[model samples]
Target: MVYPREELYPREVFDPRDVVDPREELDPRGMVDPPKVVDPCNAVDPRGAFDPRSVVDQPKVVDWYNAVDPREGVGSRDVVDPREVFDPRDVVDPREELDPHGKMKVVIGRLQVVFSRAMLFTLGLVFAHSLVDAAVLSILITHLTAEWNEYSLWKAAIVVNVQEGTLAVAHIVFILLSDVWTGPYKMLLCSAAISALGLSLFQVENVVSFYGPLVLVTLSQAGIVVTLRPFFDDQVMSAAGQSTAETQHWTSIVWWKCITLLAAASAAFGLSRINPFGTRSLVSAIIMGSALFWFLLGTKFYSFDEATGSPLRDAAHVMYIAAVTKRNVEYPRTPNQLFQNSSGHVKIPPHVSWLRCLDKAAVVMPQDQEKPGHICTVEQVLGAKSLLKMLPIWMTFLTFSTVSATGSTFFLEEAASIDEDFNFLTFIFWQRLSSFVVTFACGWALEELGRKMKVEQRMILVRMGMGMGCCVACCVAAWINARHWRLVDSMTVSRLVPQYVLLGVMEGLSIEGLDNFFITQVPELTVRYGPAFEECVLGIGKFLTAICIYILTLLWRWFGEDVYSSRLDKYYLMLVVLSSLNLIIYCLVACWYGDWRFPIPAEDDDIETANHNPVDEAVQEILLQHEKDSLPLLEQKAGQDTQTLRSRSFTRPSSPMVAHRRFYSMRS
Candidate 1:
């Protein structure tokens, strides 16, 4: 079955050395060295031949050029030659930790290293997943009513809405429970299992079919958001190095890009007519199944542990709670229980090198550490005394809950008109292309803008932009009603594009940045909250929208259509005006926004100066014990050489671990 090796690459027929040489006299340092070409079997590849099993297919990538030493050269190694030294990474080693589970994992294939495939898959799954529902509403509902005589919007919404609500509550409960007692792996595994179960449930048929899987669908999404945030962030952080303060920043950018790409792909696939099976069943099955595969299975290799696995990292976080607060570790537990306390003063082991331990003690929280919180001093609250620690928590709730929430409203609002004249696929194009174009443009704008400003400034701008954008959207609606007041049919592509485009622009400006802000400001444990935060906002926004919609409904009934339509412009304008007002308030609030203790580096030089690991309170507690009680014990526990403190006890706490003595970071 294998094709002849000759067909793949004809080594005997081609010699790259003739075209390019590593030992070119013009070359200074040999980075441009041509790959060393050996005979068909690689008798002597100056770069050393990688084994066949190393690559996926063992691609017979023959070295196109052989390393040649010139008689007149200033010494072979002394002179840089491409043949002498081409980075052999192109020839991958399968044994070189190709598996995601490997302790030292390379960025899965090269492109994944560059773009993050795991996250790409996750984001794409969700983005594409929406298409199924959109179609369900667009086609299935229409078909059901016309053919089966069984379609009810209120019923359908109730089913989905209730299921979603139940799912959200269960998800929060699960997250809280897991945060305290479970390892990140356990939660991810459980989530994956639950997601699979939920998807399978969608296959069931009933009079309440769509409504039936509501709880399952909701739970599945919660699991995905909770698990995915850390899974993606960890990969990005490990590969990125010390300046990973904004690992989520990179994650958000990739996430948005993938959303755009998926939207584009869905547009391309648009309403398939391949077999015309039960459209509703097929759509539900696909969505649930994909969610299972992506949020649960495909990411088996990608989880939170790798990102936030170190004991040192966890201990530091727990210590942050202790160091800042005067309270003992006996505090009540929350959903996230990385926080712990110690009342007794246990002796510090003498052999421990406080400074050396302090060095590595600086590692960021592993991805598995979800919803990390900082123990802020009373002053850290920035005068929002009542809202200090609470702001981040409530804000996160508002953001994450909104993911699928606003989504429903937005898609519903856009029920796409289709003419029976054209083929089904053409209609798909309109919906998809437009959606993707909007998503992509927004991502691009945010990334481009992110690079220009300080992260703190960026944070403030995003919130203001988002609140204002919402207002703008409302206004746009108002304008649409105003300009075309008399003619309902007068609204054409031209008018629609302006409104749609503006909404899209606002989406780009606000959403990604808002997501990024949440991720950046919190500790590593709380990084998982990024998506949760965004989704919450969406949830809240949807609820708010729902309430508004209800109020609108009441107004419509009381005032009648003529009166309501007449006031539509006023309502829209009111939204715009309110948004402008909100923007002002948001900017003012953001002025007080500060960086997480560690934020992403702003420049190249920061790469080094930024923390490899810093000895913050978390580092101190995990590294050593209280000075008063532990000193005698620690002094006794000193090394055989009586020199460094690193040779001592690494055990459960029995003492107050002071900051400086805890981490030998000074020496580190």
Candidate 2:
């Protein structure tokens, strides 16, 4: 390996800054040939020198590991083969060297920070809303009779039920309107203002005035629930960052449920004790006002996406196009024969053959040739098809939701009869607590399990488990109700606690599971509005519960006269049988359900395709032409400046020849 005197280190073109001995030389027959030194002034490209013959030449070394120095003026004997000179890869595997466990620790630590921050801000809103809810639902019922002498228990129940029914309708309205209302914060602000006004109006002494405030409060509450739930879910998504979207989405939901639990606990355990209506109203108004203020403070930081047009309209269009095109065109055996939208964004229709009837929307009729984009895109058809597929599952859950509604009504009555000391608020507290603990725990457990299974399978399993819980809860309730009917005096709140706990377990899993399923399964454009849909489902459930209650009221003979005397055990038993049947049906449906065939492409891959796509190029050129047409005056005024700016903005060349030309041109 010893170098000869002449070849070790050549002095020609050698820089003083380089540390090499000029007297030493390298052997001519070493691993590589002697280095050729070129003058910086005479070089064709100063970036690096390469042999002209190297274009078609094989590499000098048999292996990359045995290659000599790539740099100039360092011969083979002076510089050892790179493989001989220490290789870090030889000693350290990157996965082991970098502390793989530390990466997980970092992610978990970041999640904790995001969770804490989101909880701190959102928990305040939760507290404020919970106060308003308790005041409106619980205190107002007793307050109208205790203070104003305006209502009987029957009247109060009727009024409350009416208010809730109105709210449910309003929730559905807002969910449908979400596509038109791009600014959720505007709704948030309006909800707060209306709620504050409603709370303040309650201070009035007149009985006739109550209805005005009641209507405003009910609408405001619905607006807040529809707007804020989705808004907060979006907020958590933002804080979570993109890498862990699924985990963060689930975590955010869990945190939100926990906050609701805290709110209920606050109301049931603390706010219910405040007997004075005016005082309670004032507190609610202040908290609501504070929530509004807090929301406004963070307005600049919030990132809101513009709403795409309504999914309902898209679904409608899909149906219309399919019907119109059905008779004119022959169905293509291969999906590629059908009209595929140039934009990869819209799901290709014919690919999903299961929904063959809907695929008619993708047929390009003569009318479509004359006017492109008038016909429905494949994406619209896919979205509509997905809705059709999920309908059975939604209906099953809708039936299950009836059990939840029973808790607030008959279940509350059962608890009250058991212990007068336990009261309405205490029952709400226990219900909230059970929901919080069970939901948060189950969500966390499922999240861990999700890593091992596909998301689709995990969601189904969670729902099935929830269905089992509901079945158990119904069985318990039926037994308790039977005991109450037979003895009439042995019921206790402590005895009803287990039922609440079980119901909580059922609801927690079902609600979270459903939310997760829809958030991912629904149209990508509507992902941000997922929580609004959840509210709609809940609203429908409550509405159905109202209907059920009304039907029960009609059958007075079997139900006795009042809460204590009513033979509600039969109703409990009925639900048990109904839910058992529903459970069986759900199992069959879950087993049958198939995932959406048109999986949305990843955002990064879509961007890359768009950059290179010929169709995208044409569209971009059209956009650029439009821009030029719109800015003619500006272009004329700053013609030279604009040209110079455009030229400067062109991506710089990376090659040596281009760099050299640019360098000389700049010097000139």
Candidate 3:
């Protein structure tokens, strides 16, 4: 029978029942064949002829399955068995399909989640705090010597050194308080308020007022710096979920910090041009107050953990117990024999062969088992070891830190002595701007390198070493510049650019590398204290610098009352020698240090397995059930085909399309 045109070739709106099967009208072998079924939805022409060109020249389909609904357009001729179409083995993972770039998309999505309202406000606070810090550092010595005209250059330098020392001490104290008594949120609020008050006090001129406000501002700034990163990290991890990796989280922190520093540098440049140092201080206070208000607005979104016991105290306790415990006590034969709580309250690191002496603390004596407080856990012993191991590496960076402290004190003084009319770039502005630029460049380069290399921990140590090397180079350049200035009658500030640039590069690499090392290498219990310990070391470095200066001034007239006649070239050479020695020591320490970039498998595996989503498990179970249900139907169809084959002569089709048509014909 001749079918109507509408029945032969279905239009876009035609019902499935309206389309006639070609096999019914013509022999299956003689069916009209298109060149290829490129566009399955539009294989036929309006006149019921197979359209090869239309099929071949079709637009690319993004969502092929949804382009034409199977339930609506599929006729008897197009229908295929569900078993053949829905193979579980062929199913693509939704994550792979959705994320074309794999981990890149995931990292980007995590960053998007982490940069919430609370994080943005936190960054705002960082920017404001950094701006205030840069302003204070830039103007403190200048204000003392030039603006106030009361203190000599050496005295002003001493004041700056004292401020650095105070900052270092404050970092440790504030971080301890945050970890043991006050939470980070309260500490941040209090510190910001105190900093604002101190900035306001810059309006006063007396020595008592100057020293008092200097101490207050240094203490408050230290608290803010030591507390902010850890707090920000907590907020990020909470927002991004627990699955986020340490590298991505820390990388994001560095990127945000770079941006904050860049903006702060721009502000410092503006503050440098301001007539009076007090006006700059007042502007900083206003910015800080506004940031404080902004942070308060996002209080609801911040993640706040309760104050816990101090890790430092726990480490000390572990050492005391280990030392007080009988020296004759035998070390545990195996790690399992060590004192671990039955309830699994603490996570113990895998036993290492080194530091076997400390394992005595974890040994359970026959009588001490009943008294719980007498013996320390394996976790605590390992924590003490971790802290002790970091000390050598920490000490190596002291000279680097001392070199950094000079940027605000002697570097500023040197730049001020140069003819400003010859060079517009001031010390504070150039140093900050160069640092921001170098930080951005180095971060980008390192990120790209990290993708190709697996040596993350090694690279951190190398980067730090490179930074120290740069500090040595910076000091050498400073010495040369100083010598040139003394030799020339008219030397411009432009000559100091190389030293400032090198110093910036050094700060970018060493500071960031050191921060990462502290954050990642420290035991989990003491992770919050890492930044504070770094600051403490930095403070000690400042003290060492001060001592060096005092001794040099007393023994030889290296620093005079002002910048003009001082033997700064000699001082820079001394710093160069010290930094070179420290760089060598750092290399030795790096050689002794073990790689900690990859996590301990024993501790992480359970955490990774336990972190699986329940919804994903449920979906997998449902798919398994579907496959089980589908098996019987497939078997039944195979049985029916076998019976049909036995009853009649059977011939296999030459091609897949012919077989598909024949199967449909037999079913019909």
Root-mean-square deviation (CA) per prediction: 21.2, 15.6, 20.0
Model 2 residue pairs with clashes: 4-25, 7-26, 8-25, 8-26
Candidate 1's TM-score: 0.52
Error of 1 at 416 (Å): 5.9
Q: Model 2, poorest ten-residue lDDT window?
A: 659-668
Per-residue alpha-carbon lDDT of candidate 3 for residues 1-668, written as tens digits (9 for 90 to 100): 55696675657667787656866466343444454334456455545566535543343444353345457685444555466689987887764333322222234542432344566667777777778766665457767877667777777887788777777767778877887788889889999999999888888867666777777887788778767766776655544454435433544545455655665566655765665767778888888899999999888778778775455765776777777764567754433345542222123443334555776776655555334445555556666776676788888878887788788788778767765332223555566666666655775466557546856667777778888889999989988888888888877667778877888889777776776565455454455565567778888888888888888888997888888868988888888899899888889888877565213333431222224344433433333332332111112254342210000111222211111110110000
**Top TM-score hit:** 3
- Residue 358: error of model 2 in Å? 2.4
Cα lDDT of candidate 3 equals 0.64
Task: Pull out the clashing pairs in model 3.
Answer: none
Candidate 1 root-mean-square deviation in Å = 21.2
Q: How do all the candidates rank in terms of TM-score, highest first? A: 3, 2, 1
lDDT scores of the candidates, listed in order: 0.39, 0.55, 0.64
lDDT of 1 by residue, 1-668 (tens): 65575576477876665555535655553434255322234333344456633432213233222323456544344556565466677666654443343323324432122334455455544553444433433233234332333533323333334444444445444554445556455665565555445445544445467444445545655654454444445544543434333333434444544554454345336545432425443554565466546655545445444222322223333344444432223322221112121211111111123211211211223321221232321111111121123253344333223322323322232232212222333333443444345444654454456556544435335643564555456455645655464456433333334443444345444554454454344333333443443444454544554455446546763112222233435445545565555556555556545433222222222112222223233543543332232111112344542211221122211111101111101000
Q: In lDDT terms, how accurate is model 1? A: 0.39
* Tens digits of per-residue lDDT for model 2, 107-129: 46435423434334555665677
lDDT of 2: 0.55
